[model samples]
Target: MGAAVAAQAKQGGAEVLWCPEGRSTETRKRAIAAGFSEVSDIAEMARRCDVIMAICPPANAESVAGLVSAEGFRGIYVDANAVSPATMASIKAFAFRDADLLVDGSVVGSPPSTSKTTRLYLSGSGEAVAVVAGLFSGTAVDARILNGGIGKASALKLSYSSYQKASRVLAAVAHGLARDWGVQDELIDIAGGRSTSYLAEPTYIPKVAARAWRWAPEMREAAAAVGELGFPDELAEATAAVMERWAEAKDQSLGISEALELLRTDGPQTAPGPSAE
Candidate 1:
């Protein structure tokens, strides 16, 4: 995702800089391919760039904010990670002593490549938000300014992803149950006849599994968001658990049926009760 954004921004005449301090070889290769200059130091990149965009997993958002803050960066800081509103607020407080320096941002949809498929929703002081939006003006990234202040954009993102990821998990679980009941074929046939397809596709499990590890933290963040809004968070918690179960197969990309078989055979098992009670 970072590579995609960097590539687009660079293509649009922006000088993209990336810190390759602790990143993997593959990550470094991608960043270089995306036309990003390696800064080799976070503080240097922070000092050089006018606006610092933090696009990372929800779990690392706070740490990234701290890293930038420690560098004495007082420039425009955009937090585009999938985190709860409260977390966003904490990051804003941690990174920028002045609230005006933080532009709360959320990226919805896939990474921008050759097409304008991603929308970056930003909310904060109007001037700061506008400045951040201007950075991606000619790029493939579509930056939109939200009316609400900091945390609103993050709230919208978490709310949207909660349903998106949870529904995918629900579809997978439904297929698993049908397969266990010996009616998988019938379920698919029924789904085919419906307006909205009910059957999970062959690629569904594999596609989701490949990113399940990343989704786990997002799911946890979504759970926290829902809980804060006085909603039952068990659904999101269960979805996170399911994603964690498939984390081992993230790179395997097994088919839906194969993934289900693996889950039934070698995944987490229920404890046995006393024999016949």
Candidate 2:
């Protein structure tokens, strides 16, 4: 995502500077090779850059924000990471440590790149929204500045993730059932014809399965939020349960390969092939 963001900015004639954590990582390597000036520390990046876009995982986003605050870096701080509303609120509290304008943001779909399609959902102070939108203006990204406070943007993300997670659970569970009943492929064909699974299967299942471990906790969080809000969370709960199960099977629990193998309806001899003569 950081690479995509940097590429987008560079494409729009902006000089890209990077300050990635640790000595070496994929992003840091790519940034250096891409001719971006790499800053030695977060404090330096915060002091120099007009915007500090936090693109880390939700679990670590707030910590990074706190680091920025500790550095006394002042600028527009954009949280573009996926996190719960409560988590966002906590991060917001830490972000205001240095009196910086904190803008809550959620990147819907994928990052801005040649082959990716997604929207940037921004919500915060009106002026901060404008500033964020302006930064992305003329870029290929579809930036939508929603009207709400800090947590609103993350709420949108949670809602969307819930829907996606539910669909994934249904696919894997149904696929498993069909295999057990000895009618897996046939059922898959029939179901695909009449459901969104047909389209989503090729689009999201593989992606989700690969990183299922990282997402199970977030799905559980969403389920709890739904219950707390007095909404019917049967789907979310079911999804979370399925994900948790997938996250704990075999030594390779929470891995994509394991889930893919577990969910496979077609055996080695039954998989698609050329017709017999």
lDDT of 2 by residue, 212-261 (tens): 57677777776665556555566656666556544534334244344555
Per-residue lDDT, model 2, residue 93, is 67
C-alpha positional error of residue 173 in candidate 1 after TM-score superposition, expressed in Å: 0.9
The candidate that wins on lDDT is 1
Candidate 1 lDDT, 150-178, residue by residue in tens? 87788889878887887776566556656
What is candidate 1's local distance difference test score?
0.79
Clash statistics: count for each candidate: 0, 0
Candidate 2 lDDT score at position 242: 59
**Best model per TM-score:** 1
